[model samples]
Target: MELPYFITWSKQKAPTTLELSKNSPHAFHIVEGSTYRPHLKKIVDLSSMSYQASFGLRNKMITEAIKKQMSLFSIALPKHTFDLKKEVSLRLIEKAKRYSPQTGKLSKDYKCFYTLSGSEGIENALKMARQLTGKNIILARKKSYHGATMGALSVTGDWRNDEHLLPRQWTVRIPGPEEDPKGEGIERIILKHGSNKIAAFCLETITGGNGVYIPHPLYYKKIQSLANKYKIKIIMDEVVCAVYRTGPFFGIDHYPFLKPDFIVCAKAISGGFFPIGCVLVCNKLSKRYDDKILSCGLTHYAHPLGLSAIKATLDLTEQRSFQKHADEILMILTEFARDLSFRGFKVRHIGHLMAIEIQDKLTIESLIENGIYASIIRENLILAPHLNTPIRLLKSSLKTLNKLLSK
Candidate 1:
């Protein structure tokens, strides 16, 4: 049967349909920290991949927080009018400050803006950079996935950008680590494009959808030097890497020497409860909008429910036990990847985010039969289970994956 709605990125209906359980309309029901189909097939879901269920499904704290806010008010427009928005914004600012490299105490030097998704955050960041520098060109790397929106897609370097190629007039594509291992391609692009015309150098701290490509520290060092020399603002896209996905509050936290002008994040911050994204701007740039009418606003900009979810999610991330469990999961994935490599599998992982290279085309049916449901990006299998997945369950899932890959 054909569905009424169109699915993004798919030419036809999915190969399998998950029947929602009788108790819940949602397809994948959560039980004891694991997701399962209605038919009782325990799905080892490594598919959420830090974007959907960073804190796992049906979290009591996040649910209660959102519910509490819902009881009061669901939507409040013109953020400044509401006290709850201010409170949550302050809390979020403080959390972002903890991960800042430049005098973490500079709370006055930063401002936060809320959006609907990571792409919205990227769009806002680009606007701010362009407005501040009075330039239109954006420097982005190839094989990068920033967002799906027009402005976001404009700076995006992946094949998804091919669909709307005309919006990329102001974007200059640079070589990724895979193309130019030495990382000199960025400087070349910057010089060719003329640094004065470029407003910002936007990129993921660690590449997400294209592939989990972690750059060498030297790559960042060079980038930092060039940005500083050319006066180009740095925008770090943390859509898939923020909220403890990479063993830190933010992926850029791993690179201490690099100070980004704007940090765009979403994903895990939602706690799988509300769709929200934000851009943290350095005071130097944000302050420009203090008196001037810097145009950018969303009707649902600071929805009370989304703020509640973010507050609860941040609270959970702050817990010592939560951090410890994430560390343990990282260790487990690291060891597992090491073993897989010994068997001729090429694996790249940072924290719990991993990508396994495969020669043969692996299908969703094969994965479901093996008692696992994971994401396949081209030829790479993306393994990103929730941070709070049960230890035994995680181990069992890895074992199942190994067996399936072996055959």
Candidate 2:
């Protein structure tokens, strides 16, 4: 059977043998909290996409929240002149404040701008940075994934940007700390191009998708200093690293000194059940648009259903048990990574997000054959299991991974 829709990032238009069985329950289906596939009877998903299972699949709390909101009001609440005050929206804002670095109990130092997806969040952040600074150039790190949109893609430093025929004249690429520890490369670019020409320094809190690369602590300090000196805004892309994926509420929280102008996030915010993205804007930048028209929005900017999901997810995070569970998962992953390293495999991780360096394709194939479902980026196999996965199951999965790696 031929599918009408084009699959993104796939060269093969025709479905493979695995795709053929997608509809069969015995082949590949996720029921309740577990995934089942033909090759791997009960697959353990360690992909970052599995973060949705933070509260487990088909969570009653999130479902009830969405259903309750849907019953009470119109789901599509577009921005209009006579906009009604939404309690869900207000609650979401209050809940989000806890995760923000610039927001405080009595401080009105930040505001949330909602979008439909992480890509939209990035697009809007880029737009606001350029609009606020009146500068065109955007400095982004190499091997980073922001989004698929043109503005976000322009700043992206991977093969995803290679397909575009148009030139990205305004975006500049900077090397990671591994190559330039003191941020000399970024300073050179800023000085050579003139700081006045640059709009923002956009980067992921921890480089995701292109391998989980965590830079040295001083690397963030150096860049923040540069941004301050150059008067350029800092945009921290926490699309994947936010929501306790990195132990901290926000990945940027790990670096207490750096405060970004825009913190863009999505994925796991609404428990991955609803599609929603947010740009948490510092009051310093947002205040400039108080009287002026911000001129950016979407049809479903802050849909009540998404807001409810956000509320439910945030409520779960606020639970004492949830925080303790996250801490436990972090310890488990840290030990798992250490064990892999002791066995001669290169491992990198922060909290539950991890990557194992593998040169042989068979290792990945073997893992998949044995019921481990993970994502591969170049030579790195990403192992980001759901934060709330059972400890027994997680350890069992790790044992299988260790056995396969030993081969």
Candidate 3:
């Protein structure tokens, strides 16, 4: 079958390794086989830190799902479909409830719904907020990169957003932490837009693409206070930082006092093993829609295969060693950033994520030349390594970076 001309976000051609996948045998395939040896040796993927989950665990879960024939389904069935009632699905929901940062025990205050991608999670959250509040306006932080879908892109405040035409009703964008140090910008936007007209205030808990910008300690509290006062939904985008990416199971976990009405999570949720995202709604909001049908639905909602992956990912993350490694990686990156700053490389970092924004494209080319592939975002180098990246590998990357920058 011939593939259609689908639009892609990447400016460069697809790598040769992908082309090789076309010729490989599909049955009982082995990932560590000869086909991957050549490609794997040539590149170090520091692009998005999207491969934290071990292949061994991911494949095991997926293989189990296949054996049980749990991968069937076409449309979004009723919430109580037999497939959704399986132990795997129920476990995922329970996992979602128990993962709350505020209270460690099982929670009846929140409900979980799955989607095909992080963008769908964001879109569903917006839909729920608009439905609950009967408002159309959503306030996103400036320079935010939500997703590429029309609905998510409408709320994104980055340069790529210019390519699409979003609705005027959804055009409210607030200043980021740098400009609004105390988080007064949120309140100002709410006041100017009128609380009744705004449906939700959505933002990445720890900004990703623009820079790994961690908000002020009091920021979420201020935003939560204002949202509570006005009855607006607080939507936290944890797609990048959720599932133990930022020293906690969820980025919102760091702000225990502030319970967001909705949390959008994806990338690391299934350990990057499957395409699944979810919007977790707080108990109060979940209750409102208990008898009412949720207008949002996706074909892949609560897929058993994805649920299996989620179950395995959650179990893997619960191991004490994972959190310990997270702490170690955070310290290593922090020291790496400090060292680079002393050497005149402007580095911004939080946890395993870092952004180097010096006035030289040569620095990026130098890293690429050394077989390290970090993405260029806004003319800066963005490095987000897997949480379990070996300390030696990190040191080697830094050594190359240092040698190039000092030239």
Q: Top model by lDDT, which number?
A: 1
Q: What's the lDDT for all of these models?
A: 0.80, 0.76, 0.69
Residue-level lDDT of model 2, residues 287-399, one tens digit each, is 88989899899988877777778778888888998788778878888998988899788887887788788878445456657877677778888877777677787788888
- lDDT score of model 1? 0.80
- In model 1, residue pairs whose N, Cα or C atoms come closer than 3 Å (at least 3 residues apart or on different chains), thus clashing, are none
| Candidate 3 per-residue C-alpha lDDT over 1-407 given as tens digits, one digit per residue, 9 for 90 to 100 | 23355435543344112221211111111122354563422444565434234222224544564445454642344354664336554554454453435556544346787887888999899889999989989989777888878888898887878876777467698878867767876787788889989998889988887877777877777887888799888888988877766666677667666667888888777756678887888888888887987788876677666666676667666778867876787888788789988877777776667778756645444665575656677756776776656667666766776676677
For residue 206, model 3's alpha carbon misses the true position, in angstroms, by: 0.8
lDDT of 2: 0.76
Candidate that scores best on TM-score: 1
Query: What is the C-alpha RMSD, rounded to one decimal, of candidate 2?
Result: 4.3
Q: Between 1 and 3, whose lDDT is larger?
A: 1
lDDT of 1 by residue, 1-407 (tens): 78787757666656345443322111253233244632354556775633668777668889999999889889887545677677777776765663445665443345789998999999999999998899999989988989888899988887788877456779998877777766786887888889989999899998876778988778888888998899999899999988877777889778877778999988888766799888989888888888988799898997788888988988888899988888888889999999999988888788878888875757777887666778877878888788888788888888888888888
Ranking by TM-score: 1, 2, 3
